[model samples]
Target: MNANQTQINSLSAQSNPTPIVGIIGGGVAGATTALHLSEQGYNVVLVEKNDSLVSGPPICHLHAGGNLYREISDEQCIELLKDSIESVKLYPHTINRRPTVIATPNHDQHDPQSLFPRLLQVQQHYKQLIDLDPSNKVLGEPDDYFKVFTKQQLLALKEQQQPAHPTTIEQWLIPFAQQVDLDTLRYPVVTVQEYGWSVFRLSAQAELSLSLESKCQLQLSSKVTNIEFNPHQAKPWAVSIHSQGQTQQLQVDYLINACGFRSGSLDNLANIKRTRLVEFKAAYVANWDDNQLLWPEVIFHGQRGTPQGMAQLTPYGKHVYQLHGMTEDITLFKNGLVISDNDSQPKLPTPLLNKIDIGWSEEVVAQRTQSAISHIAQYIPSFNSASLGGKPLYGAQQIPGDDVSLRATSVWFGEQNYACIETVKASSCLPAAIKIAQQLKLTGLEPSHRSSAAEESSNKALTESDIEQYAVRLARRRGYPEALALYYGQ
Candidate 1:
């Protein structure tokens, strides 16, 4: 055995041994890192505070196209897409494979007539970037993965749907339809999870595979309250875990903080100050009777009359859709504590605003929600704000928020063996995982082996009964009658 392998065997005292990595958090970044590490032949103790695997509020679905998709490097993008393909396979019911249509009613500066061609220009740019990766040759072609709607085809389709929810094309795009009549304006570039696929369902799928791994010590309903560090010791750091109203410690050669929003909390225990940058945004879920109104996630640009200059409308299912206004300003902080606001709240005097913790409030959410509803109505004319019924169906409260501030794309403090993923969005978790793996010196495993295993796992099919049962459980937890009816009869 090599010197490193010999050392691991000595520390672990196993005939067949590997180093132990204590992964804290059950979110996408944490889960993916733990899974990838285990596949690299490491002993992973996946610890989570929730009783079930996917423990946490259901936030935004897996939006394949977003800030993460646009901002990340091309190499990172390739890894992200590959990881997403593998992950969606485990729980196909969680994702909607339809093409996402990104449109804007108000063009900021670009000529409106040339907008479709401009979109193609950007697509070609991204497509060229993805093509650079050799692994993609075997994985799939970037062009085939997405479809671009041509303007000519779109004009033709619009003529066929004439005078329906009639509107001049100059004023707005076609109304919501299963297939947008203006296909030329639509691009199937993004995908999201089914609205009802809560965190519990997504996490449970990973927990199953994690449980089957012999080397993994999966801990649930557990909390890591402290970290004991001794630089002189062979294993420099040990984690103090609290679970079942008891406490215990685990010595580790390395550690990774994949605790999503709680990452700052863990870093603080290690005496490292990292900040999480977050925005408090709201969503308004409105009812639409047209089951045929299928839309890939729609992102409308230009903020002229809306709450923010831009709005994103996501379809929860066929009959329900959610609308959100972009955050005009943001609050910055470290370790889950807000430090300052980007803009002063006009209504509240500076002194009063400073005295009160004026973060996201009921008033702000309400105003923004109403404004977003009105803005979306410009295109979706049949949309009525009254149909919003009440508060957003999916609230901001569901997302767990914590982070250790990092200025770089992704940062890890190797001295303390802790890293922070400044996730642009959850879909970018895979690149974060790959980054963590490389930093931990766990890249000894061959790339071919890793690819083969991922491929093999992707091919493992899930049964209909499995998906239906998942729906039943989700229905029970969220109390969604549609979920139960979609699976078991109401």
Candidate 2:
């Protein structure tokens, strides 16, 4: 063997009595898996083509109960609630602790009341989670999981002064009531306990935690070139990675495909055929400097992929907001969603791939961002004044099957000792890791006492201030405003 192969083999040899798991793609799924497996004493090598983790897609909302989407089933909502709570526990520093305002426009056929049943189910499920573990009370009291406001109540609050800092649910609504065009909205509005999640903060936490983990080897700016699997070998998988202008080979007992939208590419390399869909989407960043009042995330529900598509306004600190319009002209692109054919990978169109691999043109960014601004201005007329804050946060997401409506998913095991995480949301990462750990146990690989290492690292304690500092650095490094890393109303 060459010197590089010898070095990799020597490193693999040090992980005695535990398996070496090679995880591809350093997004939320891969990062969480690496941290969990490393804590359990399994040596982990995490590979990401990018410089940072959790930077693939824009994860702005913690879909507690999947309330943002109306078409998903109640079961999915409950699962999302459970998963979101777990995510908050794992990455508390990432949550913005802000509620969301859900409204139905007057022209939309879907009534606001139709969401009550699922909201009730989610509230009860959240109660159950908290009862089992009081620490799961991340969203707030189950009794107040969601609140309803009549038009009269909103009209009364519209004239009230916005609070310096909103401490209660109603206080959070004051700014929304003041700005939202009451005539265009339906009679009653619903505000849920769903909160904002910062991907930048999550990236910061994962990088810091992984750096502290002795069992995990984080390889940023590394791309996997090839994979060879032989069932007879002691280490069944040989993963070839290209990094820093050099190629290195790693021997791992198991392979985990947590590659997000690029997951199908790995399956192709492994000769594992699986049906999946990949959809590319974007959210625009805008600065509304005149509106200093801290506003809750606002959502106007409408049909997906239509002219009256859903308009979402997510607030970051320093008067910065992220906007998503579900229509074709805004967030949703024509031919953006593609299905996998006979090959495991779904080929994205070249132009879309250019936006993902390279970057969007300045002219395209300006046009689309302006369109998003106008889309939001329909509900909040004053939003027309908002200007572009920075480049749009855009990436593609992977769905396991043809169902584009599938919101909640976890780990999917392929052949023996090979697992692929098909998570649609950031919240789904923890449960996927748990299921993978269980599968590892079934394979007769006992967890080491080093499981306490995770707790010990947690004891080291990354304060919110530390997270903010790191998050700002990461945001700036990634060409986003530092305000995106700060929580609104903090």
Candidate 3:
């Protein structure tokens, strides 16, 4: 093994253990969730089909701190995100404190100051839990003198977050990239959180699946083939998991079907088809080379609609970027959840769904790959010398796959059986993990091991119940900035 691989192996060895929790996937979400749950005192056993998920190329751009900070008002989602961010910030063995473009004048985007108000607040929240503080700041000059999240601004940021770094093919983005802080990001520009991150599922359901794996177990390859809820006992659900050619049945209390996009198959878990789950295929690429330029940046490709029809990009590790766009016009995080192979679903609006998946097109891929290079080239005009043979990037993988990924998924979370979806990006994992730990505290069923009286209060952080409102409020119901009414939207 090379020196770098040896180092990574050592780190993974230090992260193994079995808590009372059994995560279903081992991607980013599962990994972060496992770390948080383990820290919270649960003897977590991260079961995955594969031993090491760090192989191939790493996912890029941790979540954007600014993007994550926007949902802080939603208590449950906030804690989970906070915990995930803290893990990376306080590792004490890595480089961080990256900056990112905070906001724009357009709608659908989040303005930094409007989002966090004070950068110090995030760091302070972290210190209360872990002894570490992360420096997350926004950089850039806006045409407007002030701050606020505009739909257009969000679109601009999202647009920038995806589509390979532009500097490789062009040398102009360097100056543009310089204005943004890379350290403050949750991950590279195109990077996915790996947990609780939805590429193809409703935000809530995706979290349930990815969190269990990345957060509960350290395994990314865990996939559930069958699940049955036993009514005989309270909090009764027996889930049959299939991984690496092995199948095992396990019972869960408060069995959460956070099974990503495929969660619709969880009908047995609820004794009925509570919601239909749908699936879409996505892929990504990553690379690590000091010679790499076009500093990585995370991009949410969709200028419109939810993830079902959107694509994403992120930079990871030293220089890893990814793209996850689907065909068949599906919403990875919303409408897609309301339909399944077995369920007769409604025809989604073309605006909300599209058949033009960015992937599946070699021409598009080459164009995007070139765009990624140009993005880097713009950021660092001198990056060409650093470029390795044929660009340093591996093939592509699913966004938070289950069995090893969360299976880009969606969920049904409305009273009348409507698709009340939410988009929880890859960066949200840390905060979600923290929220789960706090939940355990309230129930007094703290994970097998952790408790910090100073910062242990289940009531304050977040709970699963609250997300229903959050989804409809921010995503489905309310209009951007205002014109919306939702106790959950706040």
Candidate 4:
């Protein structure tokens, strides 16, 4: 069969005249989206509020893009992740070759004693549900609320049901196990029960930003506040910006909301509040020592059918580590966005964030230190006797929010439809940046080149962005758009 005949080809688009494009947000998603758009031949204006010195890793930056394509079973999500990984430029500390595991606390082995005491009071209620509504039958399936599969069945069914390339934490570990060893899989197996792949702290994104600055016009600290869609004859869109507390506007023919966490708000300003969005306040802990951990039985915990939290490990080589997390409530679903079980309120104002919470509580500090120590303890039982010298290692968190903050990321672009949001890592969001880019490219925009004498035109000023965005934005765009659209034959 011809390549076109065998491969499912969606409608293809290319930019002839090149649209004047402006992207807000400079984090990973924004950066990645902007890069793809630029590569497609667009005159692009990229903006961010942070410069190199103060910024932690890009807000969307987290554990490497775990394969998330199977959510819609889009092979393109898989290919897009491969391309993203292949094209991924990291910073100095990243260890690229280590294969990794999206881990979970082994359910059967868990100390049924329950960590949250609140469940104790509901034990009888749980039994009542189990007896009366086996399936929880609320959604029609008998297995959903009930059956917790055996490890063997989980592994077997997962292999059978999940793609050869599993993508989500559920798939990494569930029939909900979404586990796929990267082509670069490399990690040691301490025991049969505790084998895992390793991934490490990599900083390729920093390189991407530098590359963007070199090839395109990137306005640091230039936060865009408004956008005029199809704005004028000279420029189809005009973007309002806020930088250094000063406000100004720029002209462009196309606009991409690449601003990570701010993406939803920008869309909302553009009048595209399609579905509800929820922010999650998540946390992580690593070894205080920069030394390699001896044996860490990294564990993640979540129930099957429950779109909840996860734990993914990235090897920092030998002794160091990185763990990523999420909660389903913080994510958008057909029913609505999932919020924290602990919070009764709809939202929590997160004022402080960090890459490292050096200010963590003594208990939290000890727990973090002990978890790694316990892992090391298993291998080096005499570790306490050994002279280990080091001050507390540090990882910073963003002050306003971070990759974990669930607020902006949960924007469901009207039911199955999705655009980019910061925290929506559910393999669903991974390839979306590219999908949006392809659309822009097809719409006559060319990636910007500094050397060329680009055409410039004047356009009408835009009012504060608001609704009617549904008609103009992808929020209302149909068909569960995923990575296949992003990497169309990419």
Which candidate has the highest TM-score of all? 2
Q: lDDT tens digits, residues 1-490, model 3?
A: 4332233234334534322454444444554555556555565544443343322222333342334233334343334435345534422112122222332222234433343333344334434444342242121111111223333333345334323334221122232344433332322132211221222112322233334332234434555676554558433445565654656555444333333332343443344444232333223342435434333233332233332223333333345334444323321323432333343222233432333211134454455444444433332344332322122222122222122223222222322111211113344545555655555555545444334642233222334444334433433321111111111100
Using lDDT as the measure, what is the rank order of every candidate, best first? 2, 1, 3, 4
| CA-lDDT, candidates in order | 0.48, 0.89, 0.35, 0.34
In candidate 1, how many Å is residue 378 off?
2.9
Best by lDDT: 2
When 3 and 4 are scored with lDDT, the better candidate is: 3
lDDT of 4 by residue, 266-313 (tens): 666565543323432322334334332222223343442243334333
Candidate 4 stretches greater than 4 Å from native: 1-18, 53-95, 101-215, 230-233, 281-285, 288-313, 323-346, 350-423, 426-430, 446-490
Q: Model 2, 123-216: lDDT tens per residue?
A: 8888888889999999988988999999999988888887688888888889888888899998689999999999999999888888888878
Q: What ranking emerges by TM-score with the best candidate at the front?
A: 2, 1, 4, 3
What value does the lDDT take at residue 340 in candidate 4?
Answer: 26
Better of 1 and 4 by lDDT: 1
lDDT of 1 by residue, 79-145 (tens): 4444454445444554533334455343333334433343344345446655675432322344534
lDDT of 1 at 264: 56
Cα RMSDs of all predictions?
8.9, 1.7, 15.2, 17.4
lDDT of candidate 2 at residue 450, scale 0 to 100:
74
